[model samples]
Target chain A: MAADLAHLSPLLIVCCVGLGILLLDVFADPKQPKTFIGYVAVVGLLVALAATGWLFATGGVLLTQPYFAVALTLDPFALFGFALILVVAILTTLASVHYLPSQRCEWGEYYSLVVFASLGMMVMVAAADLITMFVGLEIMSVAIYVLAGFKRQSPFAIEAAMKYFFLGAFATGFLLYGLAFVYGATGSTNLNVVAEHFAKNDPGLYGIVIVIMMIVAFGFKIAAVPFHMWTPDVYEGSPSPIAGLMAGGVKTAAFLALARVFLTAFGGADFENLAISWREVFYWLAILTMTVGNILAVVQQNVKRMLAYSSISHAGYILIGIVASRSVDGGAVAGSGLFFYLLAYALSSVGAFAVVSMLGKDGEEDITYGNLAGFAYRHGFAALCMVIFMASLAGIPPTAGFLGKYLVFTDALAATHMNLLPLVLVAVVNSMIGVYYYLKVIVFMYMREPRREFETIRSVPMGIAFGLAALVVVVCGSFPDTTIRWSAKAATGNPSADSAISAASVIDVPAPVATTAK
Target chain B: MEQVIFWILAIGTVASSVAVIVPPMGRNPVHGALSLVVAFFFLAGLYVMLVAHLVAVLQVLIYAGAIVVLFLFVIMLLNIQSEDLGHPRPTISKLIGVIAVGFVSIVLIGFILKDKGMAEPPVGLPSDSTFGTVKTVGNLLYTSYIVPFELTSILLLVAVIGAVIMAKRRL
Candidate 1:
């Protein structure tokens, strides 16, 4: 019980903070700046980050606790994912402090919703059961739906909210049904139980059904190809900061959950079991998602819309790591690389959107490429940051994004069982295509003649967000060893843990093996 | 006798569901919503036949009572004109969508009905047949399923805030 409480403290603190903010917003002086709430939310997230760090330092105490019934695991992988999500939340809260007031929509619920959304993501990364994961996903999705339309007066914002809400609900249905089928096949909702069941039995027809439905559901969440129809419209219509949150924080959580499900539950050394070899499905998805995302991104006129496609392409890149993880030797390497890539992507994306948000003033948003004309001359620092972000996104050297791509591609190449060379080659080609659009933005900012003298709302909090994101990007790029080691440790633990499961349950499966075991 | 009650409830449920969606009933939104309420009530009866007493009660209380009333309120509030509702357009895309969904449903129903080697009942059901009773369900919900149960409260809270923010007269 003590261990459970200790492990659950982070989620508890975050939820309490969220509710506290609601109360504070209800009672605080109306004349006080709403940014105060944002600051409080930041403090709360930082504390949660500290809690995660403390749990990490304590090592196996929290990790070994029997809190699995709560559908959470305080494992290294979850902690790493939680830390990345917290970073996104902290940066988003900082950016929102500057943004919401400018748009006159800085309500208390905004910060609370952001915190609640982070909590949801935390729940997702920590989930060890399907039902828990679904609840977490819904929590994150609901908060984001409201956040997307925070600018209540904008027709576009409302439309984005409605569209995202309806589509997200549909996807949730897919996920829930998939989970139901999985539970039916294994007679358990626990991921460990499913893994154990599959170890002893053939996956049968229900396995394929579960995998397909889950793919559709997660594909929508991460905005993979053919499931990415809502990305551009939703991102374009949402407030820039919230768009950053959706792209950065939400994607990180969803992918981590995806990785957890596929790599832990279905990711076995079973290439011959073609029905459940999700690697093949992911390989094809990787190629299609990258190609479609880059192709669509290149033709977009709006910067936000361009980034939405860019996010989809990033999902494809992460899918490479997943496919590579299918190899027995490469599981840890590829899995860790996936986490590193997400962190790198989150930093660059949040910073880029921070710049986009800065470009708006008096409720007027600059969303188009032309709107960025000669931005270098007008706001040299922000433009310089944009250059760094673009370079990182384009996989330029000495940037985190480049290292991220390098690690994942090499990891894919290192996988012996899976012939991912063709896929990696396609990914490289897609990245080349991706460079064109990211560069287009930089060119507009730097080379093009100055259009209307850009007027932007400059606030201290947003500057802090951009600076922190840029600093992390550059530093992580320069010294990649620490993050690489950490993510690798997180990923490597799964295989050993799975082996432990079978060994431990050998004596415990005497009677049930004949009945429930099937 | 039990089969007779099951067939009556099942038929009523199907009829109301069809009435809820089929065009003329939908032309007046109120009629469609009221038909939905009838569908929900019949579904509750089906649940009762399955001995899911708690679920039957919830179906009545939550779906038939709260949800249907909310739907009626929205319909009345919108006060949408008959013309504003517009005539049903039979486009190729709509037809394709319907056909696709129909085919998928057929496939799913086939899968559900097919015997996949299961000839016995699930093992864990209480022999006393008190499994779906309110007490047993409440115990399970508050014990083993506690995490999702708590999270559901948070979901409702967030939904309330979102609804207020979206629907309130002033920001």
Candidate 2:
């Protein structure tokens, strides 16, 4: 019992904090701006982040526990994912302090919703069972649905929320049905049980059904191509800070959950079934997602809409790491490649969206290139930070995103079982195409004269968010060793821990085998 | 006799389900609601035959009782009549949907007929009298399934807060 509680501490802290913010909201006057609530949320998230770090430092002795239910795990992989999510949550809360009031939709529930959404994400990535993952996914997605429409007075925000809600519910149905099929095949919802079942038996046509359903579910969650119809419209319509959360924090959690599911429960090659393997499916998804994302992004006139397409392209890049990791010897190297890219993409994109959040006031926003003409002359500091963000997103040198691409492409090259060479070449072409659009914004900011007078709302907390994100981008780019080593540990993880979970859960299976031995 | 009863319940369930959405009776939302209740009852009868007694009870209690009531309330609040629904039109997507559904149903029937695993009891299942009992369900909820059960409470809380925040007249 004590061990279980110890393992569950981080989730508990975050859940309590979400409730605490709701309780805190009651006493504050509605007429006043809820900046203090934002502070509480930040402090709470920082504490949760520290707890995850502490659990990691102690090596989380979680494997030895007799946690028979096996609903959630606090393995190094989960902790690493949790840490990234918490960082995004903290940065988002800080930026939202002034953004809500400036947009004329200040409300305390926004902070609580953000906290709840983070809690949901943490629950989702840590789950060891399909049911628990679904529950966590709901918690994360519901809060985000509401957050997307926080600007209640604006019709666009409302439309964003409604579109996201209906589509999200549909995708969730796919996930639940997929989980039910897995349960039917194995008679258990536990991931370990599914892994064991697939090891000895061919799931055949049923397996193909399961894999495709999961792809559709996860594809929608991460906004991959063809499933990405809603991304541009939703992002363009939502409050910018919330859009940042959707791009940065939500994508990180969904991608990590996708990784955990594919790598753990469905790891065996026998899962190839008779039709086609999931690896080939994702390979095609990766190519199409990036190519279409880059092409569509080039034509967008709105900054938020452009970033939405950019986010879709980033998902394609990250998918490369996943495909590479499936190869035999690609274990830790490709795994780190996937994890490192998430870190880089999350930081740079959130930072970029934070810059956009400052430009709006009174529920009115227009971030056309014409609107941003002469931005460098007007808001020098913000424009400089924007340049760093744009450069990193374009995968230019001296930024985390460049190294991120380098690791992923090289990792794909190193793996032997599949020919990932052609995939890498296509990704290279996409990356070069990406550079053209990313630089267009930079040129507009620097060279073009100011088209109209504009002022960005400045707050101490948002400034800190910008500086902090910028610092991480520059530092991670220059000295990439620490993050690379850390993320690699998370990717491959310790083998003993995996065996321990099997040993604990397979207690009943040995009895059956003993009977067969007789 | 048992096989005859199973066929009656199965046909009743499907017929009522069709009536709930198809034309003539389906044009009126009120008729659709009542037809849904009949379909739920037939489904519950099917569940009982399968020995899923607890699920049978929930199928009636939750779907037939509470959710249907909520649906009626919403319909009443809207005060919508059949005239307000406008004329139903055949569309390209609707045609594709029906064809897709028919194709999937045929494929599922084929798989079910060929499945060798259906011949015997599942190796992992407990096929005793205690299975699917209320006490057994409660025990699982309190023990093995506790995490999901508790997390559901927070999901509900978030939904309640969201509904209020979204619907309230002023901030």
Candidate 3:
């Protein structure tokens, strides 16, 4: 019992911060700014992140407890996700500190709501039961829907909220349907039980429907094509920092949940026959999402919308890593490249959006090229920070994003199970196309003259936010070894990944089938 | 006796459910909602036959007691006349939707034919007597599912707080 509670400390800590902020808000002066609440949120997340790292270091989730739990998994895989989500939430709070007051929506509830959303995300990544995952996902989405429209006076913000709520509810419906179908097939909602059932018995047609429904629901969250119609509008309409949170924190949480469910319940040695079809589905999905995302992004003049599409394309790159990491063909593949790329991509997108949010003056977003012109001349350091983020996003060297792309593509090439070569080639071309638009921002910032007079918010906190993100981007890119090894260790949440990682390590590998049953 | 009662309740459920969408009951929203309540009670009775007492009670309390009343309230608040409703039209999209549904049905039928074991739906098999008891369900909530149950309260808080934040006139 004590060990179980120890596993729960990160979530408990964040939930306390959320409620504590709400309680403290009662005493704060309404006439005063609420950035203090934001500071508290940051400090709380820091403590939680530190606790997560400490847990991972000291033999994970409660050294006394067994490797698995019934409702939540506090394994290294989940701990890695927790660290990334906490980082993004902390950055989001820092970015919103100045933006909220500038827009005159600096209510204490905003800070509490963001903290609760992170709490929700922590639950999602740590879910061991399908039901737990669904509930956690709902908590995260509901909080974000509120944050998306935090600017209540703006019609665009309200529209963003309603649109996201409707579509998110529909996606959730798909997930629920999938859940019911899986239960009907296996007579269990537990991930380990579902995996054992699928391993022993052929899932047949019901499995196909379940897989497709899960894909559609998760696809919407990660902004994959055919389910990505909502991304551009919602991103454009949302408060800029909240939009960054959507692109960063929410997307990371969803992807982690998706990987956990699919890799655990659906991937293994015994279920290879079932895995092939979904892998093929993802291969085509990866191609379409990247090609379509890149081509459409090139024509968008609004920086926010363009970044939304670029995030979609980046999702495709990460999907390639998932495809490669999924199969177990007794190959030397050490990791999925998922954790490292996710960390890199989350930081870059949040950093980029933080810069773009600065361009919003007087609560109105003017992020077009015309508005961006002469940004370098006005603010040299901010422009430089923006350039580092953009270059990283475009997968240039000396940044985390480049190494992130390198690891994922190499994983795809190294996989012996399926021919992922074509997918990697398409990603190569797509990233090339991606570079053109990523540079367009740079061109406008340094070269073009300002078409009309415009002023940007140069708040100290926003600078700190992007500056910290940029620093991480550069450092992670240069010193990629530790992150690589840590993420590879993190990839061992599923039995197949356990086998894969163990195959490369000097230690004797455990029997994959023995653990597959539990 | 149980079989006879099951048959009666099943017939009542189907009949009232059909009444909700056709003829005189359908013409009036109030009447349709009333029929829906009747259908809900019949369903609850069927659930009771399966030994799912908690589900039967929830079917009555949530569907008949709460949801049906909410429906009646909405109908009354809107005061929409039946004459205000448009006649059903068969549009191109509707035609395509029908075709798509038919195609899926055909595919499912083929799958059922190929897989003989899955062709028949499982009917009222015996379940544990205590499986759906209120006490057992409550135990499950506080024991095995304590984490998810607590988390859902946080979810409700987000929804409630969000509704207030969005609905309130000012921050």
Candidate 4:
């Protein structure tokens, strides 16, 4: 019981903070009095971070025996996801401190929603059952839909909300249908049970269909091509802070959940019995998502819109990691690479959006490339940070983005050795294409001169947070080993660890001895 | 007798679904709402076939009865005309929609053609036991899925508050 409490502490803290903020809003004046809701949120997230660290430090002590039985597993992987979520939450809260007031929509619900959404994300990454995962997905998505359209009066905000809602609903339907099919096939929604079914049965067409449906659902979540139409409009219309959260927090959680589902539940020899291989699907998706996202980003004039497309491109890169992990012998390396890249992408993108959030004045800042002329001269510190973020995003040397790309490429190369050479080539080319837009942001920031007087709102706390994020981006870039090692460990599900199912249960059953006597 | 009812409900569902999507030239919102009602009723019938009689009843009560009424009220209050259907969709969007539906059809047909072995129903399960009926569902909802079940209620409350807040002239 105590162990359960310890595992749940971070989520509990977030919920309490959300409720506290809601209560505080009742007494506080509506006229934004430099309210400390953002600070409170950041503090709450920091506490969650500390709790995660403590949990990790104690190792197996706080790792409760699957908290909700067949539903949730409070394991090291979940802890790792919780830590990532907390970091994103902290950065988003800090960004929101300055960003919200400028937009004239400084409501307490913003903080509450952020906290609640983070809690949902934590739940999503930790979910061991399909139903639990769905609940978490809905909780996170519902909050995000509201956040996306928080500025009710704006037509763009309304449109963004409508687009997100419509597409999100459609995606949910696909996901639910997929779940139904999986249930129909295996008569169980438990991951381990499904894995066991795969091991025991020759999954013919039904298994392939179910897997395809699941891929479609996850494809929408990760913003892969053909299913990625909503990304730009939503990101462009949303408040920059919320956009940062969507890009960083939401994407990271989704990727982690996707990795967990695919790698742990649906990979290895058992999966070979299924008529269709997921590797081929992922190979195509990775190539298309990366190539298309990068190409689309290149044409975008709006900085936010460009970043949104850049995010799509990054999703493609992460898909490469997923594809690699599904290959014969590249699971561990690719999985680790995926997590590291997710961390790098989240930090860089969040920081970039933080700078973008700062650039706005009075809710309507047209952040076109031309508008950012001479930004370096006007906002030196912000411009420098933006440069760092851009460099990281462009995968330049000594940046976290570069290390992330390095790991991903290495994994891709390894997978290529196992007959995935075409995918590797496509990914390599896409990475080159990705550099153009990321560098374009830099060129706009440094080379161009400010055309008009760029009025800046100086929030000390926001500035400090941005500085810290920039520092992490650099530090992680230079010293990538620690994060890489941890991610590797996290990705390799501890089959020997105390859980309902043991590693032996996962091993392939050797073909029954040939009955020569027959 | 049960198979006959299944076919009837399935046909109704398909017809209503078609009606919901297809209304030419500035159809009234109430028409759309009514079509949704038909769809919900058919879905309830489906629930009945699945032995989830309680869920079917609730589906009709909540979705068809209450929700459709709410939709009608909103449409009346908004006084949205057919011409107010906002902007017309672009040709490209329509083309994309057609392509998407085509793709879905192709995939569905492919699966149907694949001839995967049909699942065998669990044997010895009593037909009259109400295993998937309302009582069992409610029991499971209250016990196992209690958190989300309660959370859904809270979500509805928040949605109510939000709607009132958004629509009210003065808060």
Best model per TM-score? 1
lDDT of 3: 0.82
Better of 1 and 4 by lDDT: 1
Scored against the true structure, residue A207 in model 3 reaches a CA lDDT of: 76
Predicted candidate 3 versus true structure: per-residue lDDT over B36-114, tens digit per residue: 9999999999998777899999999999999899899989988999888767677998899679769966875675466
Q: Report the number of backbone clashes for model 4.
A: 5
For each candidate, the alpha-carbon lDDT, in order, equals: 0.82, 0.82, 0.82, 0.75
lDDT of 2: 0.82
After the best TM-score superposition of candidate 1, give how far the Cα of residue A452 lies from its true spot, in angstroms: 0.6
**Cα deviation of A209 in candidate 2 (Å)?**
1.7
For candidate 4, the share of real interface contacts preserved is: 0.05
Model 4 stretches with alpha carbons more than 4 Å out: A32-34, A60-67, A273-275, A326-334, A493-518, B24-26, B86-96, B106-124, B142-171
Give the per-residue lDDT of model 4 (tens digit) for A59-111. 42323333244556555567778888888888888888877777776767777
Which is the winner by DockQ between candidate 2 and candidate 4?
Answer: 2
At residue B17, candidate 1 shows an lDDT of 91
The per-model DockQ list reads 0.42, 0.40, 0.38, 0.25
Please state what fraction of the native interface contacts candidate 1 reproduces.
0.37
Which tens-of-lDDT digit does each residue in A294-409 have in candidate 2? 99999989999999999999899999988888623213323688888888899888888888888887678788878888888987877887888888888998899999999999
Model 3 C-alpha lDDT per residue in residues A401-421, reported as the tens digit of each score: 999999999888988878998
Model 3 chain A is weakest, by summed lDDT over 10 consecutive residues, at: A509-518
- Which residue window of length 10 is worst by lDDT in model 2 chain B? B116-125
